[model samples]
Target: MAHDHQHNHLVQMLDLDAEVLEDFHRELVGWAGSLVGDRPRVVDLGAGTGTGTLALARHLPGAQLTAVDVDDEMLEHLRHRAADAGLQDRIRTVRADLDGDWPALGPADLVWASASMHHLADPARTLARIRDTLRPGGAFMITELDGFPRFLPDPGLEDRCAAEMDRLRREGGMHMHENWGARLTAAGFDLAGERTFELEIPAPLPPAARRYAQVTFARMRERLADRLSADDLAALDDAAATAAHRDDLTVRATRMVWVGRRPS
Candidate 1:
């Protein structure tokens, strides 16, 4: 289960000017090139709003995708996106929980998990299933945030927000750091490679990117409302208000990616 409304907002925020999504797919496909065959299938595990699905549609052209997620609204959004892009024939939505019984999807050439592994009830077990469902030599790529957003113009304020978010995560029993490669190895995957992407934009990002960053800060402000001190809260207000301004605005973020393959 997920906070549907919040998840949608989160998607809108991180999808920086749409370039961020392209960066993700570019890196993923770059790591494992067009592995297309007769009806190539790519599983978008825990696919939220089909961000990764749509990316694959463009880069991996001519491949079928199964977008699996428990959130129906998110899947609906994905469906519409696929339809708009004239990719509905190649993309199918499945409402299923990553923790529950696996859906009826057949083996895939590559499985893409973007910021969705943490939500699983049992990530390790689910990973093994992912491995088993992949064809020989299939690849699995997963991405997770190194930490919360650090794109504020002010580093000091961003640190304060990050520290508070870390505390909240701890209190909520959320798992933050997991050795994804090690888990994949245990799940019978041959470690392939991994990398960390630094998404940084200079001040005065495009109008869309600026609005994206502002939305991100607004969501963060809402989440830290009760926890931030009076001074910190005021600083956040200033940050949120100026997030969309072109003058002296900067954005920085890190996304960790782990790639593995099922043995041939």
Candidate 2:
């Protein structure tokens, strides 16, 4: 029951992210569409909630997509979303732990990994595998976040929260701040392009943004329950409780994307 609740919250958060940041998502999808050929075969690594899978399918009508993830629940949700979007014909879900032996997913035109590579045990090994999985001259795109977004107007509390989160992630062995471009080059991929997106949605955000703030605060509170001071914990509770109605909230985040290609 606890797992189900967590999964539901994650699903809602991902869906809200796409909705609240529609401009960025649309631009990213369009850029991806421009990189592939007609009827291209694409693979989405760690396709949570089918955000990228469905978007790529809609943007490239002729493309076939394989959405791969370890979690059965997430894959099931992706499949349902694909069907609902009338993209089931072009999209298929594969269940596999990316850190383990990967299943046969190869000879593809494009492979996309967004905010997912950091969770892998060995990203260099995974990058090499991805290179082998793609056809010669195929493209591999990786997108990673610097950290979680901040919605509060005052930077002090959010900064403290981010610092704590970073420490916890580091202790947990998450590669939250790796230089992926260097890793790709070292793993034998030809670095094709790199871009950083700095996004900021000012005060009086949409309803979805408010909910996003609430969910993010709640998740942070839960994760840092033990690490944070008592005062911080109380402040977090207040933030989560009031996030939905805050008028001064602003959404700020940074995402970096690196595109590499397998040498022909």
Candidate 3:
């Protein structure tokens, strides 16, 4: 959650380019503007490091943005990011767990969750909550990984990942949800859409990129260490080391953007 090299680099390696993310927010703003007719309030859930938050602040002028995340350190970095971007006044950072009561945030015109929905214990319920937070006809958007796209080219690695994650979930007593599209529909979104991007990261990963991966893997292990068996932990470490050895590591993480309007 902190702006360690690994965290930031993994984002750069796996997530879309800032320009692409900016373009997306612009498109979403236009869509929301068509309904609300002007700059509208938006809430960015789990706005770690405030990259998206900064982008939204720049793109959505005259907009009130609340960047909500539970991590204080992440929020601290986000605050500086906002200040550096000269958006200190426009973006508000709130520390709260999404599983609990949301902060008195807003009748937001748009609620955007990027790569954060998967972390929610109940994604459908989270969608429903996001829907409730919106004004009438306001939009709730979720961006998630599409699954291992490049895994198809690699031999058994994709399957191995899928199996490992599944095993990890089962061993941890965690119910990991894969189908966000169906979940959104179940949460009362009629007009739903999804998109996939290859996100071809270059080989011999950039130092920042590699750091991101390492930090993320370490973070994940920290979260699961208590739940995982010793063998499981060792297996995960082995897999990570093996993954790091390859010349070209193509991670096929798709960004699924699902926007649903609350029924007016």
Candidate 4:
């Protein structure tokens, strides 16, 4: 919806699945519980719609929160969400790009990015900044996609879908995935813990799924329309719909959570 690319598709798809939001909140709050003592400091990057930020605020009553995002409209939504959660005082929304120089607000106890790092042009540099902003022994958490799901009834469809995404990335300058843990280690973050979760989204694909498919196809078609036959586009859409209809969807979208420390 925002960037009009593969990463955007993944974001829209996750938006379709409300469960992902709840899980992210659960994870963030669980993490905040570990660091929050007497009024903790937390920073959320790429805080679109403020779902994660507001959720974390609900859990960390005494937290001094800063939510940063490039899109003002999304940040507005986050503001409303924070207000709705009665956390207007505890939360402050900052309109700043994560890829740029961060404003002078730091010494955070927790820095979290959910499904946002891959969108950065230079994630390594950003993570290093995040690490430096943290207080001693502070935590840096990043969640990244392992890959798209393979819930297609046809076995080859999954491979074809993956190939299409790969092609689009190479031709369209799309950033679909990343290994933030490796980047964190390179940025001098000690790996404290890690977890992986596989989610099989329930489908019969609703309008939300269709919307996501159309957005993704438009991105691919934008670059490869000359090379991609009309039939190929049709087949991809059909496969997406088919995958959405499956009982379990059996999608293999894996989310990796990496926890690192600033070393007290």
- Candidate 1, residue 237: CA error in Å? 2.3
The reply for model 2, stretches above 4 Å from the true place, is: none
Cα shift from native, residue 69, model 4 (Å): 1.2
Writing each residue's lDDT as its tens digit, candidate 4 over 6-64 gives 45554455454434335645865686567557687889888777666877787777788
TM-score of 3: 0.71
CA lDDT of each prediction against the hidden true structure: 0.77, 0.90, 0.64, 0.68
TM-score of each: 0.90, 0.97, 0.71, 0.77
Error of 4 at 48 (Å): 1.8
RMSD of each: 2.6, 1.1, 5.1, 4.0
Please provide, for model 3 over 1-264, each residue's C-alpha lDDT reduced to its tens digit, 9 standing for 90 to 100: 444654654444333334333445566545544444357788989887776677777766778889999888778888987898889998899999998877787688888887677666766677878877888878776766533234123455345445565677656554344676677678886554565544555566654444444444454455456666676567556545655555565433445566677778
Clashing pairs in 4: 149-252
Regions of candidate 3 where Cα sits further than 4 Å from its true position: 1-37, 146-162, 169-176, 202-207, 210-247
Better of 3 and 4 by TM-score: 4
lDDT score for residue 254 of model 3: 49
Measured by C-alpha RMSD in angstroms, how accurate is candidate 4?
A: 4.0
lDDT by residue (tens digit), candidate 1, 88-175: 9889999997778887776898888888887676767888889888999888888888666566555887788888888887676665
Which of candidates 1 and 2 is the stronger one according to TM-score? 2
